[model samples]
Target chain A: MAQRTPLFEQHQAAGARIVDFAGWEMPVRYGSQIDEHHAVRRDAGMFDVSHMTVVDLAGDRVREYLQYLLANDVGRLRTAGKALYTCMLNEDGGVIDDLIVYFLDDTHYRVVVNAATRDKDLAWIGEHAKVFGVGVTERDDLAMIAVQGPQARERAVGCLPPAIADAARDLKPFSAAAHGEVFVGRTGYTGEDGFEIILPGDDAPALWQALSAAGVTPCGLGARDTLRLEAGLNLYGQDMDESTSPLESGLGWTIAWEPVDRDFIGRQALEQQKADGAPYRFTGLLLEGRGVLRAHQTVITVDGEEGEITSGTFSPTLERSIALARVPVGTGERCEVEIRGRRLPVRCVRPPFVRNGEIKINLD
Target chain B: MSDIPGDLRYTKSHEWVRQDDDDRVTVGITDHAQGALGELVYVELPEVGMELSAGDACAVVESVKAASDVYAPLEGVVVEVNDALADRPELVNEQPYDDGWIMRLEQVDEDELAGLLDADTYLETLEDE
Candidate 1:
């Protein structure tokens, strides 16, 4: 039996197509996935992302524990409600999970991790947290909803409690604030301005309804995947997993290398790998012709270096196929992707194919 | 539940067949098939002159979720492929029976048409699935 979120009933009520995803019964789409994708790009759309795990950490050493456990430094969080995106790593420098940590106070913090990696992420964090005596509490009683698009903030804010709404409206990007039990973070996977709200599970349905009434379209995982792909966000299991390092997954910028003396998990291996020169470069591929690019497809660069696509989808925003790939270092501007036994030409470019309803990359 | 025209034929694979006249037949996926596929992004049609056997993987219909092969319900030489689908693949989702028709086949044996399921039988197969 798969687990269901608090919003499962609401999903069914909306005539969504339900599917099993990572041990949970989740909505894949309400109607046309392309329409949902366009709603997020052009207007406001909300997703029931309650499957994500929310963990609260409390202890005098909580900050220090996060600083050591994650690849990105939490020391950069200078204010309450400030959030930092970081990757938890094994000693071998391979990514365990990527998460966002929000500082609430010196002794209390919150982290949201991927739903698929819930068990291992909790176990890994728990095992390592013992040394620092941090109290790791999983907040399964909470539900998260991401409301996104150009008009997302405006429409979603109207549905929140007045005080929480006012505070959330003032939040800058990558910051969060809590009012009573409701937590609002001005961050999202879609490359659009929006809010990720975490509240008590029981309140989810009403809020979901309110948001819908407020003109925020109810979306699902199918639209979420495409929106995130277009935004150049990495899906943990597909883009990088326990076997891959952040350096080779276009996450070098997420690594905090400063404070040379700080010995975070995977520091030594990552430094060694950095010194040895990372062999693979993460890149984005745009198909020059018809046909969709899919994962595990072989990519052959002009120099004949073989690589593979990590994640691929047809961009509803761009009206073309795009993908994230791991190719050899120095792979140039052009390559060929083997789709259905045919090597079709593709252009190598940076990701973020679309942002804020605007095209970001050079389509020409 | 999807529309099953009483006059046409169906395969377990969810393709609908319409006998055009003497020996030719027009083929397209069923409404249930298109609904399962969601909105299509691209349609890979077979070449007009391609030869196929029954159950041969013929054309491809790609949605945002996954790509599915449209199989041949009978052995025949391809006579025409839907060109409108090249620009407007959503036609399959909008009109799986009419304008969304994928291909036409010539040289099809009349026996194969008799073997295909009619509306009532195809609806039963969908229920079993």
Candidate 2:
């Protein structure tokens, strides 16, 4: 049987189309997915992201343990509530999982990882933490809600407790703060201003009801996927997996090469790859024809080289099909994608294709 | 409740058919089909004059969530395709019965039309699913 989030009843009440995702029964859409997509781009929308795994690490050596476990250095998170995005890598430089770590204090930090990767991520973190005597506590009792859009912050603040609302209103992007039992972060997957709120699981349904009563649209994973794809964000399993490295996944920027003496996992393999220069190019593609772009489609360059689309979708914001493809290094501005046995022309562009509810790429 | 016009014929696949006075037939997916598929972003119609057998995959309708093939309900030669849907595929979602008609077949076999389910039978099929 699949697991149910705290907001599952609310989702059913709103007529959401529930589907099995990563062994959990989750809403794929409420009504029209495109309408939900537009809701996040033009106004406020909320998603029940309670299935994400939240783990708290505590000990005097928690910070040090994270620095060694993750590719991105957590040392830069100087202020409490400051968050850093990073990839947990295996010793072979392959991605284990991508996660966000929030610095709460010198001895305590909170990490949120993808739900599908929960078991492995927890086991990996637990094994490494043992040497440093850090405690890893999975907080399944918590539920997360991500409210996003241009008007997201304003509407979301109205649904929170007064004191937390005031504190959350002042939060900068990528920052989080706690009030009582609720933790509010000014961060989101959609390329819009928003807040991700984590609170006790039992209180989630009431909060969802309040947000809906406040006129924030209840969106689902379908809209979330489209919004994230338009923003050029990577989905863990589709974009990169245990066999893929950050250097070739467009996530090299997250790696911290400083503090040369730090011997993190996969450091040696990454250093060797960097010295040799990464071979594959990670980039975005805009379909120039009528057909919808989809993952696993073969991409053929004008010069006869080949690649594949890792994630593709019909971008509602841009009114065009866009994709993220991994191609041969030095792949140029133009390529052709094979859709249904016909080669369609495509333009290579630096992602994201849309941001802050605005189209970033030139259609013409 | 889904709208199922009693006068029209439907396929188990969710397409509705209307026989015209000229012996030709017009076809489009039902309202329930469009609602299930969500907002369409692209529609790939078959070329006019193309030959099709009953149940042939004649066209495709794509939404943000997925792509589905629209099968021909009866054997015929395509006489006209909905060109308007090339630029505005949402017609299938907004006006599936009228403006959203996918194709008009000129040479449909009269015997094949008899095999399609009536509105009541089609509604029963939907319930079974």
The number of the candidate with the highest lDDT is 1
Candidate 2 per-residue lDDT, tens place, A1-364, comes to: 8999999999998899899999999999999888899999999999999999999999999988998999999999999999999999999899999999999999999999999999999999999999999999999999999999999999889889887988999999999999877999999999999999999999999889998888899999999999999998999998988888999989999999998988889999999999999889799999998889899999998889999999998998888899999998978999999987789999999899999999998888
Q: Once model 1 is optimally superposed onto the true structure by TM-score, how far is the C-alpha of residue A49 displaced, in angstroms?
A: 0.2
Query: lDDT for every model?
Result: 0.94, 0.92
Tens-digit lDDT string for candidate 1 (A1-364): 8999999999999999999999989999999899999999999999999999999999999989999999999999999999999999999999999999999999999999999999999999999889999999999999999999999999999999888988998999999989999999999999999999999999999999999999999998999999999999999988999899999999999999998988899999999999999999899899998889999999998988899999998999889999999999989999999988789999988988888889899998
Which CAPRI tier for candidate 1? high
Q: Model 2, residue A98: what's the lDDT?
A: 93
How close is candidate 1 at the interface, in terms of C-alpha RMSD after superposing the true interface residues? 0.7
Off by over 4 Å in 2: B21-23
TM-score for the A-chain in each candidate structure: 0.99, 0.99
| Model 2 chain A: lowest-lDDT 10 consecutive positions | A156-165
Q: Candidate 1 chain B, which ten residues in sequence have the lowest lDDT sum?
A: B14-23
Query: How many times do residue backbones clash in model 1?
Result: 0
Query: What TM-score, over all chains together, does every model reach?
Result: 0.98, 0.96
